[model samples]
Target: MGFFDLKAECAICNKQVGLHRFQIANKEWVCPECFKKCGFTAMTPIKTMTASQVQAALQEKEKSAEALKTFVATKKSDHF
Candidate 1:
């Protein structure tokens, strides 16, 4: 009967997620922390993704972050 009673468990982190959460295609909830790690935005079609897809997206984001760390700009281009 309380707000906390409606909380859902995150499929990835297994933590209790608040009302402001994301639901996957299979209806499993995702916590804010895990959502942030996936780098998803409001424009992302997350509702159509499965839990495994979400996990894959998170792993892809981590790889992209690691790759970015070693990236260097060899040339700067200016467009008028």
Candidate 2:
């Protein structure tokens, strides 16, 4: 017996579809009929953040941390 049994219904046509014929995304089982009706000729592809974008995000996070640290240090010194 298979460990996983895949079964789903087309969102558009309401026809039963085997798991192998379609894909699940965002908790939705997208059948070919629904995909075609939605005008999606190809499967949605995954997107990866670019290295520069990632680096920029990290830099912004680090800047926020530094600002927080400076604020905390000033507040502590003032209390003492």
Candidate 3:
């Protein structure tokens, strides 16, 4: 078997995730692309989130991005 043959399918995208895979709380592996959609940083909660929660977070991310398009800053910070 080749190096790529050891890849497993991502729980979310169903894509072949290679060695660099993220295992979620439920023990499901997620692909790099799908994990990017999560936008999670180096936080403990990320490791506790299930595949469904990650999917929900992705949806929320999309909605938040859409909402930000029309966001207006009414007040500016006095100090940086």
Q: What TM-score would each prediction reach against the true structure?
A: 0.79, 0.34, 0.74
Encode model 2's per-residue lDDT on 1-80: one tens digit a residue.
12145666543345777764444333334455545434444544312333243335446666877798877433335565
Q: What is the C-alpha lDDT of each candidate?
A: 0.86, 0.47, 0.78
Which TM-score value belongs to model 3?
0.74
Q: Rank the candidates by lDDT, best first.
A: 1, 3, 2
lDDT of 3 by residue, 2-80 (tens): 3345677787889987788777776677787887887876563666788888889889988999999989999999899
Each candidate's number of clashing pairs is 0, 0, 0
**Candidates in descending TM-score order:** 1, 3, 2
Better of 1 and 2 by lDDT: 1
Off by over 4 Å in 1: 1-5, 78-80
Choose 2 or 3, whichever is better by TM-score: 3
Candidate 1, residue 35: the lDDT equals 92
By TM-score, the best candidate is 1
Report the C-alpha displacement of residue 42, candidate 3, in angstroms. Answer: 2.5
Query: What's the lDDT for residue 54 in model 3?
Result: 85
